[model samples]
Target chain A: MRNVAVRNLCCGVLLVAVLALAVWAGWVAWERYRAANRPLFHEIGWPDLVPAGWTPPDVLRGMNVNRYQDGDPEAIDALARMKNAWADAPAVKALDGRLVRIAGYVIPLDRENDEVHEFLLLPYFGACIHVPPPPSNQIIYVRSKAPLEGMMTMDTFWVDGTLQVSTTDSPWGQAGYTLQAYDTQHYEVPAQSNKS
Target chain B: MPGILSLALRSAWNRRTTLAFIVAAMVLATILLLSVTQARRSLHESFSQAVNGTDLIVGARGSNVQLLLYAVFHIGDATQNMSWASAQKLARHPAVAWSIPLSLGDSHRGFPVLATSQAYFEHLQVGHGELLQFSQGRMFNDVYDAVIGSEVAQRLGYAVGQRITLTHGAVAMPGAAHADKPFRVVGVLAPTGTPVDRTVHITLAGMEAIHLDWQAGAPLPGMHISAEAARRFDLTPKTITAQLLGLKRRSDVFAMQRAVADEAAEPLMGVLPGVTLDQLWELAGRGEQVLMGLAWVVAVAGIAGMVATLLASLQARRRELAILRAVGAGPWEILALLGLEGLGVTLAGMLLGVLLTASLLPLMSAWLEVHYGISLAGLSLDVTSVTMLALLLAGGVLGSLIPGVCAWRMSLSEGLAPRV
Candidate 1:
């Protein structure tokens, strides 16, 4: 009778131990699944790049830009003023060195074969060809440690990286921000999100 | 289970010859697939490493692709050379940090000659911003001095003090050699695995001096200008094949490209090397895809052969399996026996294939370097290769299961009776 009782006690302990091990294994697996599915970088938008209550210089506030003919002196002067304003555009200092994700169009700089290593990320398409380029604050120079394959000019991508307040000098003038991108994905419309 | 595994092994050993043939086929297929992928990767890496640091290649207004081929790879002739004045103007631009002018169209013993200033040695970068290092001697100082690349020195058996003459064009025709103005080899550069390794370097003055009396690609008759007398005349280069430019700020490249395009004095263009390389790949990527597809077909054929061999043996093994079922073994044991054999054979084949590839790659790498000037990285099992091997493993096991299922059905129906 004592042997039977001892055997039953051992059976109960083994059953409980097995159940506990299964629960612990399930918990670890669930944690891993959550981590794999979670989005890594915080999603941000173009407006986040600009500081609140800051406005662009109104160099051409009253002038009618379209009325002037090509090579008109007044038009040229206005264009120069606009360029100067864009060149000195201020960046949002608070967001410097923040890891964030934003969608932008690519203008490939350094590349190898079909892989792009460095590029300019603009908030809108045709920024290079448009009459007036985007302000310095709107331009984000992105660099990748490993080359991104099959990236082309004007291709939109959701770039995730650490943003910094930096400046790049060009003919039009200085760009205000740069990104050291670790990941870039094709841009897709978020489901059920309101599109402006 | 242990007994079943041993039975499977012994059964496989009974038909070692057939299994060996299947394994050999798998080995050949694996080598082919891996080599194609490796070659494609190395080709891109070699091209990219050749022009790593230069921001732009400015040449005469023409096809960007043509300019890239001529300027970077030295594969073809430049249609026209841009004027020295335009090159100087570009050099003086605020955004231009430095520029190296290149003058081609001369050869020495079938190797193309590159004429540049002292800046080339100081500024030109290769293989990820690595500066050129001389293995022996130094850069040319005298007007008649020459610098040979590593391959040029090794192949021609030249030393630092040897004298060599330039040919007017790429090919060596009779009397085309510039025998009057032989250049002394002042320097020998280390191997860079680029077009540079196949070239002979000289100053722009040396190039001008050698051709001072020549006109329209031929020597002028009755006009013999000695090397000493040639120095008295102007040695300033009037035209250059191309110039490589580096920018003060990388973001200034697009604006600088536009500025070069809009030059009113001369028709000139600037091409981003990386962008142009992408264009070249797009034109040739279809051929690469076809090669990869053929590799896949070969791999699939290998797996199919393994399946066929295992199925053929199943008919012969039916009696063996019935005997096992008769001797206190269950139907599942019969199934496990065949499945284990198929899996074991495939695993052995894969191991041998990997070993063979590892041994063969170094020899292949040397051959490719000597023949094509491509430098391949060492045997690296990157994610893509690992994934391919994994997929092959899955396919192998899945293919072997077919024979296993057949034996299971045969054992269930036969039941200790000889069906064969």
Candidate 2:
């Protein structure tokens, strides 16, 4: 009788403990799934361009973009990632055709002597040039009514325009969003934020 | 309950050294299996990205794999050059967006010299739609000017405004140098993980001018045409190695490829970069699978070692099991205790394996990227790896049953005292 009681006590306690752990894990996972699927209207940054919970999406974070040779599996996955980085970009349909101001580096697409009418706006420098391009959403194709002057590669600019959820394919890179620029200004690093 | 748990812990602590050895073996096996799987997957992924962006690679009719090797990767030599008339006809097609002619034969210190037009840099895309960028200077404009790739400049220690000469063939030997027409380095392209990094770019006209006075493979005897005087004559290339074409629509790729193959001008072929690349990977993937099978065998051996250690220690543990039976412990309880110890060791080993892989991957990946130019994705565990770990744990528990059943039977036969 005592042996049976002891066995029941030990196995019952362990089973309950394991069940508690499993339930906790399931609840946490559910919360995360909800957060990822929630309709969000917050202002986004470069990283936010990729859909929530996507892995291996950041162009510069993990791998060296230039190293994988042709016919290698890694090369194939990287190409698919580049081609379809913005596959689910339209999921955030609320942001389409909305007016938004974004700050980015200018990669001139069509330009004359000292001005540029159309350019790719990137979150960081060297994108679409030396480094593999970021996802489509991270790049914004901007066509300005008036040309911006003294523009060169890696020049930072703050552009105010209507964000249309569209993909533009250019020789430089594919962009998920196209902005019709009404205002443009140079972006300068603030003195306080420089070191802090 | 507490009594049974205490017994299992003390019993495991007695053979801690053997348990440690078993865990170490499992750790090594896990690392090897993971490295091979990750390397093969990443290689195929990176290669597909390079080929998918381009529509068609039009070259001389030969092996599909061979054309991919030279045209896309700049690896081997082209057997024969297609006539310029064939390339021009394909370029002028209404469906073609842009076409860049590639002429490969000469080399500068082992790096292939590609004599193409300005359109090569302007239209050629890498890693999605990324265009080429000049890291140091602009593209070559005049004859006798050269644009070096990032790897070529770094390896040869040549900078813009530096002068370098090309060899007649692809080898870096000291024979048949184009010494009279040394090219001036005008630009250095940024590091592109593609084959472009190891290429030296120049104009097709420049290639024609350098070989103007040459006949067959050697310079014409008793005839010297100065670089300036050679410019007076026609510098058009009569033949080129291949042409890379971009179509207005991707749907036009198959039609254009059919058109190139059925061309009356010359016997030529057009290969879709994506299709040919998949075929090449199919051949290489078989070898990788065989290697992975070997890795699985190593993992199984590690598990066998774990089971052997448990069984070897069972004889010494028989006396302990007999004493517990004398104290009214059930035969089933003996089996449970031994099985629990096995589960404990394997679960700990698996946790350690996860930590070791997470930390080791980032460190090894950095070295791999710098030296081999292969970048591994994030070290976060994938679904396949998680499934493998679960299998390892399950296999470890099943393996533990051998010694568990032995201890159970020994306790039944020898109730108060062990034979040993």
- Among these predictions, the greatest lDDT belongs to 1
Off by over 4 Å in 2: A1-196, B1-21, B151-165, B168-170, B176-181, B209-234, B316-380
Which 10-residue span in candidate 2 chain B carries the lowest summed lDDT?
B367-376
DockQ of each: 0.18, 0.02
In model 1 chain B, the worst 10-residue window by lDDT is B370-379
> Per-residue lDDT tens digits of candidate 2, residues A53-126?
65645744687867878657787666656545433343244568777777888765433323466666888776
Best by DockQ: 1
What does candidate 2's lDDT look like per residue over B90-109, in tens digits?
88887689999999888887
Give the root-mean-square deviation of each candidate in angstroms: 6.7, 17.0
Model 1 misplaced regions, further than 4 Å:
A1-102, A108-117, A126-138, A143-153, A159-176, A180-186, A189-196, B1-7, B155-157, B171-175, B317-330
**How does residue A161 of candidate 2 score in lDDT?**
77
Displacement of the residue A121 alpha carbon in candidate 1, Å: 2.0
TM per candidate comes to: 0.79, 0.62
